[model samples]
Target chain A: MTANARPILETERYRLRILTPADATPRYLGWLNDPQVTRYLESRHRPNGLDDIRAYITSHDGHAGFLLGIFTKTGEHVGNYSMRIDLPNAVGTLGVMIGDRDHWGRDVVLETRAAMLHYAFETLRLHKVCGACLSTNLPAIYNYRRQGWAHEGIRREQAIGDGGSRVDVVMFGMLARDWRQRREMEQEK
Target chain B: MSAAKEVLAQAFDVSITEVPDDAGMETFTPWDSLGHLKVIAAIEEKIGRDLNTEEVLAVIDLASIEKLIAGVHRV
Candidate 1:
């Protein structure tokens, strides 16, 4: 809960901890190495080698926000979530990667996203937060919509993916004011 | 229509018709585990209020939702 040490963000069911080099192998490698896992990620094709992972860790060593390792109360590593600070824009881009298939369809991601959003808005003082996903990722798109992000637009065939194919990304965003409104409505209900 | 019905409909993306006449714990589909939090979020946004966990769970029907809104006004 302290600012310096990465604190555990407790929800009704799960806790999130900041990632470290020690989390490199089990948490990172487990997902980074899986083609199915990284299919929608920009770095999908990056060779999932130890050297590559080490470089990736170093690259994100002092990032403005964090790439956190999410866990259950029983101390099971479930997946990853990120809060990327865009200082120039005075906003943040939130991301989540849930590796455990068992946890899908349970709304854990939605709950976790909400918890992180609360922290981002209340603790970090962010002006806005946004998310993006492959146009084909229906679950992600649906979840984001349910979480109150607006569909900004789509990029047409902008990036090449693992198979030399192009993928269009659907973008979504929410301002602090809108988030506040949504939170207020939830409270009143 | 009660204020609670309006708020709940807007939040769950459902029409007023979707809510049953005897809607309670058994009637609302979106009133499930996850949707409950979202319903809470929508209510907070519409009325600019905060709800404690006890208050949120105490909500079982439209009347409770209206009561919560009324209590906020009283404060």
Candidate 2:
């Protein structure tokens, strides 16, 4: 979708919009460079800079996949959430980061993921959505579970974490049917 | 504990009485990287201003956060 045509997803506190090259500011780069922020993330494995951010925006700007910037209702650029689509499989791999340290522990990811999942199953008519994260990342694992993603399996020793420690990658997936059922169950509460 | 310290205690899910005056990531088991962010966000809400990068980094402990909040109110 074109930038202007991109759909904006909203939650009670956050607005998810398309990320553009204009967001590659020093502050954005700062999050990439902060080891504390990027730890347990694949981005930490690469050398990230403005060029990388710009290149990312250019490549994914109008594709089936969406790279969204997560902003507060007041428009603070706090972080990003992305979904990469595999059309043949009707599945999307999800990723997210709350770069603004001040926005952590606020359930922003949960809200954004819910909005993205709604678009995935309801709007795009996708069959499944999956995510993978370092197993050591307890908060992410908890959030995904709370959102009804089933624990698929572990990719044993799949990645290196801080200080070169090998870590298992946990995989989680949710089918559209399961999502619908979970929503119904929640509403009945 | 001060109000900012109380906020930190809530973010970390500890009792206000249990939160020490110098509670921080290094000293408190619950104040991990994510917990640190939560504390900062809560402090910002309490103080009514967004903290700069430098101030955020400087606020490594309860005393430091109180100091930063004090500085913001002083201006």
Candidate 3:
């Protein structure tokens, strides 16, 4: 796909679309600055400014990896979903951030994840998708578990967390066949 | 308080009496993201049903929770 060619994925209450340099606003930067929001993310380890965000956004353009902005249906940009596609291996790695605390606990993560997974497996024809999270991020781990992702493994002392403490990184993976089966089961229910 | 409000109060570790009718993330002090997840889990347990994506996102406040629960039970 071209740099500007992005698929828009929609859930019941939100939309996911390609992120552009224009989205590197102060509000988006504030999400990075919020220690509470980025506590489990590597971004928290380093200070970030608008220039860094703009460069990050620019770097993804026309790349194998994709970054999409998460927006409410009413046009509120709340967070982001990034996927790194490895075409040769037919695999993708997923990452997500829900910056808007107000939208938390509302299953927005699951909704956006479902949409992205659909794109990965159905549209991109990827065989598997993987994700990783800090072990302390219970909500993210729970979200992955509920969505039928397998607990691949854990890397001990993989990264430093908030307060400079070493933390394990939990890895998760899901195959396209398994994801399709789960969707079928949900539909049957 | 309604059953949903009771669930919310319990999840937030507040008294049922303390749960305002319009309590939400914006209005409730303890309604943080983690607290919101607990509230949803409690409500799901109380109702004996898993909330779908739309129902989950629809719950924003006491009124919305009550309404969504009523709709679920109505079905």
The most accurate candidate by DockQ is 3
Q: Interface root mean square deviation of every model, in Å?
A: 11.2, 10.1, 9.5
Candidate 2 CAPRI-style tier: incorrect
Least lDDT summed over 10 consecutive residues: which range in candidate 3 chain A?
A: A1-10
Q: Cα deviation in Å at residue A9, candidate 1?
A: 1.2
Q: Write the per-residue lDDT of candidate 2 for residues A54-76, one digit (tens) a residue.
A: 99776674456788899889998
Scored against the native two-chain complex, candidate 1 gets a DockQ of: 0.03
Model 3 ranges with Cα > 4 A deviation = A1-4, B1-75
Q: Which stretches of candidate 1 lie over 4 Å from their true place?
A: A1-5, A61-63, A161-164, B1-75
TM-score for each prediction? Answer: 0.67, 0.71, 0.72
Better of 2 and 3 by lDDT: 3
Q: Rank the candidates by DockQ, best first.
A: 3, 2, 1
What's the residue-level lDDT of A65 in candidate 1? 68
**Chain A TM-score values, per prediction:** 0.88, 0.95, 0.95
Instruction: Please tell me which model should have the higher lDDT, number 1 or number 3.
Output: 3
Model 2 error, position A120 (Å)? 0.8
Candidate 1 lDDT over A1-189, as tens digits, reads 113336468889899887666666755577776777777776675667666766655554334666777888998878888777876676888888888767766778778988788777777767888888875454676577667787787776767755787766778888878888998998998
